[model samples]
Target: MCRWLAYSGSPILLEELLYRPSPSLIDQSLHAQMGAEATNGDGFGVGWYGLDTTMRDMPDTRGPDVPVLFRGVEPAWNDQNLRELARSTSSGLFFAHLRASTGSPVQQTNCHPFRHDRWLWMHNGLIRDFALLKRDLALAVDPALYPSIEGSTDSEVMFHLALTFGLTDDPVAAVERMVGFVEATGRRHGVEHPVQMTVATSDGERLWSFRYSSEHQSRTLYVSAAISTLRNLYPDNPAFVGLSDETRVVVSEPVGSFAGAWQPFPESSYGIVQPGDDVIGDFRPREP
Candidate 1:
């Protein structure tokens, strides 16, 4: 499996989460305590929503403020470019992933945080028996959207499947449908546990995360406690400085060990972080 994180609210240097934490995302890339593998060295990717400071004053010149992507086929901890990029960039919302390929090739295109339009997606688990079910799942994608799949990883396919099922209009429902279809397809191929995932996605505005497995033993996933709550809990923690009440993050595992800073996402559930109150609700797969 992989280790990934999604952050929203309060634009700050990406390194604050990617590297500055005690056991940060970069540290997890090599020493992940909750991942299937200790080392996620196949590849890495980071996607963030930010406008160039130089262009912020000229709104029209900024064009569309789509997320920017920086991916590499090298180990994240070993990549100087990744470190430089993380330090130089800041975003109100961003996603970072360390990939440990299940069976796919190690390549730049196979990295996580796949993109389409203003959306970004990344997954930390697999579609069991993917080789046996790939054909059927690929055929189910809408023809117009099928061509957008640029990688051979099941993670990419899952994203396109969600898009085909209407992610833009309703993200949680689309993912439920996507998982349902994958499970149905896998059953036909004789795979018992068809899906295992802890997925995070964002549309440059709101962020959504899902944790589920057909066998009901999904990988670990954590969401940061509300900034206000954490601040009250640890009034002098430097980490809370400059963070907004709306600041939130969802991770495959806790990025740091600060007391009460992270909470486990319930099994087979989904959560959304948006403008007002964030929501955590039960997730049920539906037939696409």
Candidate 2:
């Protein structure tokens, strides 16, 4: 299994969460407190939207919503380049993941935060018996998007399957459909409890996070208390003072030990973070 975090709010340097926080993602790469394994050092990736530099000529228009990605096969904590990039880059929405391979080769393309036209996705779980189910799952991807597949990891395939099932149109339903398909295929192959996951995806403007397992015992995941609420609860903490009310974060675990800073996302649930109040709702698999 792996660990990941998705952030949305006022623009801030990536290090603010990736490295500055106690038990930060950098720290978790080598000393995770709640991952299936103590370390997730196989590889790592970060994807974030940058200011549309291409709009110099037509400043009023927005360009294509493609995210800039930085992926590496090195352990996150050991990668100086990632540290430098984190210090220099600032984004309002971004994804970071620390990978601990589950039978997948270690390579740049196999890193998390897989990206598409306007989406970035990462996962922290496994599709049981993936070797037996890879072909069927890969076939389910839209033929047009099939060519984009570049790695031999179940997480990457899951992202593409969600895309084929209309993720851009309705992320929750698409992911449910993807999971349902996995479960059906696994059962067809005599495998039980086919999925274990805590997935996060974003379209730059909004973020969706989900946690579910076929056996009802999924990995750990937490969503931050709303910035406004935290501000009220911890009036003296400077960290909550400057952040906007819309700031929200979802992590594989609490970023720090701060009391009241994090809340457990219910099992079989998904959450969406957008302009107004964030929404947390029950999640159930749907047959494709």
Candidate 3:
């Protein structure tokens, strides 16, 4: 339903990931190769970390320091401001999303990469029969955090649910619990399938990406082959020569047609990318 990319590594200009590739995220915004739709023009957003505002004469203002966000309710390819920002801003951990709203209104608030505190999240699929489950899920969120929700998208609800379930402390467990609750509630209402999602979240450092569905099939999700591997494959491609071993990416689709350069995440799986380790784990349906 949408297209997105999450990148982590040495600081680099946003355009390197959002615009430079043959079929970059911006290209996917207008001509997606694997998404359900060809265009994701509903809206777009980008989130990046900059040197802490309090830091002075920052050698590099980019990287994991302060989180900055740019969002607009306009086609990404047509946004002049996005183009300028992509060229000027840089970061080691960043997220870019192009939306094809699934029943949600086309507004800035409805864009993905919704943030709360130090975390940022984005989703590429929807919650089945959301209208039926919305109230139930809302009632379950911690009252103290409910007032922070600023939009009416299922994606936002999912984020808040994770926060309520201890996301800040144990993201994997919190998300599992949230999804378990969703599955249980949906089954009670006679919905055979109640979820379809490929979600990513970050707290300015490590990143967590998930792929799951109530049914067997889920949306497309991929993680880039390590930069070292890419360098070995394309020795002459100077673009990746300076990247570190920990540099990695998780994207909605392959940014280029480089065979074997992008690996499809296993169905019903989730991945965690830490400073030095990247791990993929199974996501089995929870028993109601």
Candidate 4:
């Protein structure tokens, strides 16, 4: 139970995505349009990557560009510091999440957009009967990575499971395996529909977004049509006029009423965004 947005493209100030849009992530925190709840004020977080200032000399490796993170137990819309930072910092890849804390406490650590090393993750759904499967899923994580666990949310545990299943190498397969394992474990413990999710993750370069549920129906998740296409469609809208082809956003819902500028991700599918101007890779379930 949360709402999130992931942006990867030409560098833009965080406010451009978190506050300026008509139905920005901050607006969703107070008045979500498609989320299960109207207010997702339990907690919030933002993670972003910028040029690795320390590696100015080395062009071979991506370098030690540490992500900047800001999280708090307060609602996103209510945080003055968030607004201040959003206006000041800029990044090519960033993630923002507002929580509707299911069973977890309304604390800073329980916020979405959990991070590990260079990876950042956020989820908008739950693992049904989590209490029953928590122990099993937690144990499934590599013991070495277990100590890093700091929160009590199912979303955080799911991140670790994906890592254990080799997310860094194969995010799609790792996530599928994670869902399979969670479903299997949940069924063994009597949960009818073991999972529901619309999740996003990034390693500061590429972004992966997935929409799935044990049942055929799942929560809302959408990716913006290419900015070039949107600009063409809404030629008179000044807000979209300056956006380049590389600008892309994936969110739980559209950020504004630019018709045809957003498309719903098909149920039971995932999308991968690579480093290019508006290039997208779409994936569906493999044949049984």
> What tens-digit string does per-residue lDDT give for candidate 4 at 135-172?
98898899989998999999999999889888899888
Worst 10 residues of 3 by lDDT: 52-61
Off by over 4 Å in 3: 52-66, 285-288
Q: Could you tell me how far off, in angstroms, the CA of residue 108 lies in candidate 3 after the best superposition?
A: 1.0
Clashes of 3: 0
Error of 3 at 227 (Å): 1.5
lDDT of 3 at 271: 97
Better candidate by lDDT, 2 or 4? 2
Tell me how candidate 1 scores on lDDT. Answer: 0.92
Which wins on lDDT, candidate 1 or candidate 3? 1
Better of 1 and 4 by lDDT: 1
For each candidate, what TM-score against the reference?
0.97, 0.95, 0.94, 0.91
Give each model's whole-structure lDDT. 0.92, 0.91, 0.88, 0.84
Best candidate according to TM-score? 1
**lDDT against true structure, model 4:** 0.84
Q: Which residue pairs come into collision in candidate 3?
A: none
Best-first order by lDDT: 1, 2, 3, 4
Which of candidates 2 and 4 reaches a greater TM-score? Answer: 2
lDDT of 2 by residue, 1-288 (tens): 899999999888899999998878889999998999999999999999865344435643335477888999999989999999898888889999999999989999999899888799999999999999999889889999999999899999999999999999999999999999999999999999999999999998999999999999989999898787888888897887888889999999888768888999999999999998789999999879
